[model samples]
Target chain A: MQLVDKDQVSKSLGGRLIRNNIMKFLFLLCTLVGLVVLVTLIVDTVLDGWNYLTWDFLTSFSSSRPENAGVYGAIIGSIWLMAVTAPVSIILSVGTAMYLEEYAPENRLTDFIKINISNLAGVPSVVFGLLGLTIFVRQLALGNSVLAAGLTLSLMILPVIVVSSQEAIRSVPSTVREASVGMGATKWQTVSRIILPAAIPGIITGIILALSRAIGETAPLVVLGVPVSLLVTPNSALDTFQALPMQIYNWVKMPQEEFQYLTAAGIIILLIILFLMNSVAIYIRNKFSKRY
Target chain B: MTDSQLKEDKNMGTEMGTEIGTEVKQADNASGIIESGQPVFQAKDFNLWYADNHALQNINLTFSENEISAIIGPSGCGKSTFIKALNRMVELVPIVRTEGHILYRGDNIFDKKMTVEELRTKVGMVFQNPNPFPKSIYDNVAYGARVHGIKKKKILDQIVEKSLRGAAIWDEVKDRLNQNAYGLSGGQQQRVCIARALAIEPDVILMDEPTSALDPISTTKIEDLIQQLSKDYSIVVVTHNMQQAARVSDKTAFFYQGYVVEHDDTSAIFENPKDKRTEDYVSGRFG
Candidate 1:
């Protein structure tokens, strides 16, 4: 009746305890690596850029003289690009996700599309820039304008937005849809009223995260050939633009050591944008999660 | 029964003893079958398949007006599937296919003219778990009306009040109508779901284990509510709990492996089921 004989030597609990402690310590060390790196980077940036991070630095235009250089034009250009990119990417991705989740029939074609979309999310951002060069910049003749850059960035992040939005849509319980349909709601009605509202928190969070990625991305804009040091802000989508990351990249490669301080300030600005975006996402998630 | 037929029944003004929860069995003693008058839904040799697997087999059952019909079976006995078939909701599954006819008000639901939306409008459903929309209690009840294009705020409020009252949770939720439905207890949420189904004014409501997830007190409240609602609305419920079927249903259908083993008055089904399987199931020897 005994599962284990009393004489049987149990797998050494003391050895297991030591193994567990070692594994826990290893994980703690791994976490500390990331934390230490992040804290050090932030501290270094602050120490290097504190003098350059002034109100005047934010308001003034970029200059050949590092002391007078500012990110005014880059900030406005980033904002303008986002105005187009955010709406375009959110609308297109949500629509694609809805179609794939709700309307698309279960078939080989749909399966192929799903797999392609997931794979596309992992594609290099530089490749999307190349695609933009061929399509938006040359074939469409949009030139090196904010419109072209926004479209290119939108394309680059579309797969990520789609994948996350699909996840959001999937999380809306099938029971909710069933209840809607059982009450005579049409397909569109169910999607718009029940599914969309329930999934909005998740969708918005995904969108904000995607926007953060798009905002920090330098390689794609570099390949798109956005101006790195424009003095004038882009007032229209058709106007030439420069982004914070592009400006930082230009400054980092410059000969003057002071430009490195400007580069650090630009990184700080980029981090601020990232923090604000993530904060908004967290707020939305918390407010809506309480309801459901 | 057609819409006009329903109107005629309404005109009868509850004169017949069968108008409410009072049992009026139309029994052929020789055949030992108790058929109620004025059938609301009639499934004739209905069969359903999910891909190659047959899920419901030759289902021939009639649900009469103003009565609660309970479908009792073990897990995976196709009871839920059968209830979903009433509103043509089973078609939502891509692999599902059906043969024969399910007649709702004397017309085959599979007919080209009878749209699924229309069928569902006449026959609403409440799921096992309370699935109120993540919205205000008022909005959750008003959702069905809004989906049917009733948008006036005044009308929506009125419908919401009437539906919550119909579900017998109006007093408890009246002050908190604007609050999120999810903030309410599980029982209250289920009542909200019931009120939501009531808002569309469906003649028949299909309930798939509506109280299975609730506490005993909530279950009792819902059972009492169901008994009262059956005075006006025909209800078809699927329950794993036999005692619930006994407490709430006027008629019971015993399902086993996708077949209706026995269908009769609740008393006969529980007291003296003809089928050996039904007897064993009712006696708790086996499902």
Candidate 2:
């Protein structure tokens, strides 16, 4: 007699569906809010910076008069800083990740160390600036040179690289490792040939992301007492340097309208560098990342 | 029995005919030695533990050279663990500990002088799942040789072709050797895994349910490959399928609750198992 009865079940099911749709719409609204803000910022920057962004402006040295001012020194200094930061951060992060994932025995000490690294990633970048000031800048006597700033930025971004790299390395299937070791591959051989290759895409992506963050960082360099305006570009790791973000920060604070344009231009250049870095990393990942 | 059954029976008896052909092979030295020649692997009182759990207890068995020995057991009975222990791959687990000696060519495999790397080179393994590397088929096959320092392109190419042929997958995959291994069907990938194992030229091949993940047709193909391979290399296979163990292996080892219930010629084990547990398990009773 109740075979065709659908009233109670259908009512509850329809109610649940309505509730689910409402929640989905709410989440979508939240996502759109963030996207809208990002789009507005990008559009505003492009509009403001279009006229000031030029090869001449990029190639000329900083000037007290906004008309002749260029980010040439800051651009070169950023390049030099990146040259030091990239290799150092990648080597240290990948090594630390490999050690924790492959070599270190699972124990309370390792667990504690892992937890500390994760927590360090969430620590404010300004704290690392202070650490650099106390350790590299003052204690080691490296001074406020490019090396000190680079090392400081490296310390600031190291946790991000290490955490992401660890995730990548950990995500590599154990079956591949077992297959390699089963074939009599030594530990180092397995790491170099099998594990490293499998994890390269993730490692490269993480490195680029970390470097991009470091490139745009100004707090640590500012705390390190890097000059707001440098006329000459840095040549060596030890040479004092200025980054694009620092230039942008200095220009944005000036009361002049032309300096405000320079700020947007600097922001656009930094965005381009970040975009290029990410695009190259994405291309490499797509080309080399195996589905398995 | 059918004609094919008779042929398989004769094939099974070839190893046991000389010694213990009529008698049951005892657990230790008495039956370990084959009158024909030395065994490829001889396990004596092999016990393993994961922390406090006794995974394998006193696993005493011998795998003859150029013969397929299948291990059959229910789930969680240490069949896979016992297979992994052959190549010392079980040590990957943090809490795993082992006792007793496994001898390969009359040498103690666990001796300090013989490294795990050396032991692994002699014992190649195929997993329960078809686990070819994510690289191209050619690269997957040549991975073992490359790790062993073989760098000559000509030699690697020849080895790859020969291994693919040996695993009976050359005809199917020869044209696509450069293709990624993951692009192939499950059966094709399994064959590639076997090809990879063959390329290493190990003395013993440990297969942990090589066909468990395959369909019936693919399973038959792998079983045929296993049969053909036994003429040149010793194979120790672990399987959950009793019928597969009966069909593919010369001898079947029955494990229950971390112990070897019985290990004998497949015919003997299936027809009249000495242990009650082995009979019940083989008969599809309680696992």
Candidate 3:
């Protein structure tokens, strides 16, 4: 019952080892390619924009004079956009996901809708901006206000949140559902009590990610015709406002060299916000995962 | 009997031997087959289909109150399906359709007047795998009570304690009621699930291979618990292990190919099955 002698085994293992090592090295090289580019960009941005990240630079608004330019208005505007976007998108997406997964009848029509939603997630983000431009801005007459931009970006990330929420809801064990129903729990009781609690961690994580994507997006707001810069912070949702990515985009286009540094600083600011949101997501997921 | 004897019996044209059992059976239309207790649930000409496939056909059986009824069959033989049908939980499947009536306490369960929630409150189930919800042990046991709208903490505490004690796991889990149910061992989790079902104070308990996932000691523990619980509630267990059915049940129903081949007193069905198929299944012959 010996398949091979020890020496032959070792010889063949050595040959297999060569193939394994080659593949391993190739994967590592591919990984490092992305890593190296990201690190270089971050390091270069830090170095180029280090002097521009002053308190005065942060406190003031964007100026024609490059040295006095700051992202204060853009920061406030991004917050406003998110304030409108987060609640509207999370509610709509989660509700849609719940309906489709829980209440919808099983048929080709539902299947068609589910497939089209997934396809919509891959559709270009700017198309959603045009959709918002037509619906919210023109038809609804909301203007190019923060409401218009917020609704636009919300539409863009709607599919992403819907997909993630559906996945979270779907991941709840059927056994748990059976147990609940077997206990004489009504369908609503089972969903609200068992299914929702289990799915909240995943749904929250999805919402945070979708919000993160919305915050960093520039093209949709740009197409919505949000001002490149604003003088004052938005006092209401309907007020005209600037956003972090839009500010950076405008700065990058300016000929002044300092505006280039300002763009790098804006990227750093945006990254910090994203990193914070993602950290919260991971924390919530880990905490809830341990409880179950 | 030997193969030649069986062949000769077949040639003599006895139709599967269901007609001539030693005693009056559930399969018979006689209303007084059960000797002592009243039948809590009965399936009269019950049939079920999963879309075009007939999954259960003309199932007739009676489960009496304050007794344990065992449904024994091989895999995919509709044992679990029949048990689930008792509580109307089988309707959850999208393609499932059923014909004929399953009577619960002499009321037709398929009648539109019997809401699913009302029906389930009287019949609870424990699954093959231990499915403890991702919540506190107290919450897990209290789940059924809470669903019925008992929100008082004092009442919930009493119910939780009673249910855990009823399932015979209070000693192991009493100290950790605040802890997560998932933190327990597999056997304890199954007990917790049982406790959860018990919290509803159901009239009938349906268990689908409740101990198939457990060790020998755990299985024995649950078997003892089932015996004790039967004094209060009617029980139906679907099991692949014939020995477990014989050990734990008062009545045993043998199912094959979605038909109830034989149902009688536990001893009689095991020792003197009239159906050729039932004898073959019980004696380690081909299922």
Candidate 4:
């Protein structure tokens, strides 16, 4: 070979080095920006409400006057909403996921259903609220009660549950299915005994995350006509409810400075509850993951 | 030749079945005095297709009770498909189509009156890789029993212990019964799978390369377990490892390109093969 050009090789190597450096710089910049934004949001929330967070603020109920406002009713309402919504959403989501992943044939109709589910997942929360109002409250004649709100929330979170449960069910190795079938287990037996147990942790984690979203939602609840203030805890599904976010929205909109402080207190409490739920979900995931 | 080489040649001979006819002739002479009963399972003119691609072509075989029958073949020879068809496991695939009858104790398993679930309970299976359920070790072994309606705790406990013992894994895993099954080693998991199958109290146990995923030691252990298991239950094992077949099985069937080229007593098939294709396959000339 006519003496390989050393100069060209060196030049190309230098160019490659420069390009690599620029690519690394861009990656670092993006990561730093993301971390800064996340930290800023957390810090702002903490600084705004640090002083207002107290035990009495947490334990007391709501009041008509902004000065005496507490989150007891709102907290209870959130708890009740979660208790009702989570089970319904989970059952519907997991069932849908199982039917789609395991039983449903690969056809145009099923494919269409799957595509619509993903699209529904992207639909705005307010749209879900509107759907709930029309379907559950008006058409179903359930009224603007906790039951209606819960049903609405259940529908709102259904897509999340389905997607997560599908992923969980899908993650179970094909070898497991083959082994079960090889062992002479019926399809249903294999699903219930093997696939479901392996996927339970993932389903639970999805439910927790979806419930967190449901807890913080305000636009949908507003559309459901959940009351801004409620003195008594809801005793039945038909009773009007006030969620933490709605209560905070009511408190923050008040002209009084004390109410703004109370709003911060409410925000802190909601964050703590969400944090606890997330932690429990993480714990369950870790525990089951080890077993799997 | 070394012991290993001798063992290899013996395996190669079994796979080829060049001497199977002679071996069967000798066996006939020796066993002419003894009376044999009906086979546990009889498949007559069994044919299977996967959407027009014939997977199994005119397979006819019968498996005896309390005997180990080994199916040896190169990859994609329809050995697995044939075994799956016995218990209606292949029906799960929408594309799979079958013709002919698989009779189990005088009743056609494919009859409309017979359910796939009922057939499966009678014919349990173990797989190539160990697949324990994501449950406690005790629960993993107890699952089959529980499914068949053994609800009492003490009864389930006894079944679990007995099945584990049957699979030769009870002593190793007895203390850690409550531990998650995933924590067990690969060999233990495979044994646990065997125990799970045993807990169902099936009449026949189907094994598809049950030791292919394990180390040599584990393979030996599983082979021993299989030999022991055949004393009580009919076993039909599919193995790519020729030595494994000679080591454990009483009868050997050599399959080539989806056809059973030769089948006879293990000693005869190994000592003198009857088919050139099987001989070539056993000699590592071609799959």
TM-score (0 to 1) of chain B, per candidate?
0.88, 0.87, 0.88, 0.87
Backbone clashes in model 3, listed as residue pairs: none
lDDT by residue for model 2 over A44-112, one digit each (tens)? 999999999888898988888999999998999888888888888888988999999999999999999
Top TM-score model? 3
- Computed on C-alphas against the true complex, the DockQ of each candidate is 0.60, 0.72, 0.59, 0.40
The C-alpha RMSD of each candidate to the native structure, in angstroms, is: 8.9, 6.4, 7.1, 5.0
Global CA lDDT of candidate 4, please?
Answer: 0.84
The predicted structure with the larger TM-score, 1 or 2, is: 2
Lowest summed lDDT across 10 adjacent residues in model 2 chain B is found at B20-29
Candidate 3: interface RMSD equals 1.6
Candidate 3: residue B136 lDDT (0-100)? 92
lDDT of 3 by residue, B47-143 (tens): 9999998999999888999888999988889999999999999988989999999999999999999998999999989999999989999999999
Q: Rank the candidates by TM-score, best first.
A: 3, 2, 1, 4
Of the true interface contacts, each candidate retains a share of: 0.94, 0.88, 0.90, 0.53
Q: Whose lDDT is higher: candidate 3's or candidate 4's? A: 3
Tens-digit lDDT string for candidate 1 (A5-104): 6554455666888999999999999999999999999999989988889998899788899888999988988999899899999999999999999999
The docking category that best describes candidate 4 is: acceptable
- lDDT string for model 1 (B31-108, tens) is 233346598999999999999999999999999988789999989999999998999888989999999998998999
The superposed Cα distance between candidate 4 and the true structure at residue A109, in angstroms, equals 3.3
TM-score of each model, in listed order: 0.90, 0.92, 0.92, 0.85
